[model samples]
Target: MFSSKTLAEMDRNIAKYPPEQKQSAVMACLIAAQEEHGWVSPAIIAEVAGILDMPTIAVEEVATFYNMYETKPIGQFKLVICTNLPCQLSHGEEAADYLKKKLGINFNETTSCGTFTLKEGECMGVCGDSPVLLVNNHRMCSFMSHDKIDALLDELKSQAKKGVSA
Candidate 1:
């Protein structure tokens, strides 16, 4: 379920398409729902399908197909590191390993405090910015050397201490 504000946002997204083609707004609606709920659950998917006049399975298909959509609950800060071939050659693996060591969690694992989740991701389309890390699927940190990575971790930890979302 979503808040009224999120529902209003979804309505706005639906309004972008013709009345008869409102189903085209499925992705936007799902994104709005995920933003509110932090993940796309089956009930949320069904609700989105109902709003868009789509089948629940269709909405599920979209959510499952996109790596950006979190079907399962994730930690507050989702750290997705790019590990494609180009990035791997540019210390992406090194960055990933450092994160694992620093966080004491491997890929697809969340920290015990539930403050951070680390995931290995595909190319973020910025090969030049290898060792790029995406925070909560939005903020992008590129050219992550060891010092930079340490600074980032400290900043995130500080944010967590301050009860800030990053």
Candidate 2:
């Protein structure tokens, strides 16, 4: 189910641990699969389990337990807004509402254009950076005011038009 390059990457990850501890590489292997496929599907989970010599349920638990791993396909850009109490106190809810209204999609839904997917995330370990969001689980945007949010949407839309990846 994975490409040669992806399997090679998984193999490299597996090599990081001792022979008897191949299961320790399960997370890394899943990440490689997700990177290649854009989401962790059932097939991917089984494949990773087979490769790491672990139970499928074990791999599934890891995938579902983490917010970073997407079990279903998502848009090109995944916007995860931290809606925990600290973030809510810092306008996180307002920001999330703004995004939902602007994109015409609620949390867990993707835009009609398939350009963005909105999700409410847990604390990202930066309570002080409340009202923060992540782009594709990588880029972090802090202190998201309305203006900043608008700017970000505009920028992402422009990038989408240009066939750019977020």
Candidate 3:
């Protein structure tokens, strides 16, 4: 379960709308819980259900349906790769192979350094930007090559070390 503060925030999420539309807060509530916990735990899903006045199964259904929400813990930099139609058509599998080799881990596994975790994804809705990866859920890496991926890892490591030292 989340702390009282998170529950209060969940309350405010639904309060913004009329009481009848509390279900609208379900997604936001799950996102909030996921953001706090780094992965949506069963308890967090139940709490979200309690917040939105929804059945636990309904919440679970939504959480499980979305690839964006992780049932298991992810790493610091979540490297999400696209394997949908467009991405696959445009070398997505090759990109995945490169990533797996470079990271020394297969899909759905985290690197030993704990810097990243690999996630094989469906359409990220950026089909045009096929063969894309999202780092830290903020930086988007697209049209990747093995060398480019290596550079990216180096840069991220440097940035993280800098932040730690600071």
Using TM-score, give the best candidate's number. 1
Off by over 4 Å in 2: none
- TM-score for candidate 2: 0.93
User: Residues 1-166, candidate 3, lDDT per residue (tens digit)?
Assistant: 6877777777888888899889988877887787777889888888788878899999999999977788888776788898887998998999999889888999999988777799887676787776788775667777777777888878877876665310
Q: In candidate 3, how many Å is residue 83 off?
A: 1.4
Candidate 2: the clashing residue pairs are none
Q: Is 2 or 3 the stronger prediction by lDDT?
A: 2
Off by over 4 Å in 3: 1-12, 159-166
lDDT score, residue 74, model 1?
A: 86
In candidate 3, where is summed lDDT lowest over 10 consecutive residues? 157-166
As a whole number from 0 to 100, the lDDT of residue 47 in candidate 1 is 92
Q: Which ten residues in a row have the lowest lDDT in candidate 2?
A: 29-38
**Model 1 TM-score on a 0 to 1 scale:** 0.96
The estimated TM-scores of all candidates read 0.96, 0.93, 0.83
Full-model lDDT, candidate 1? 0.92
Candidate 3: the clashing residue pairs are none
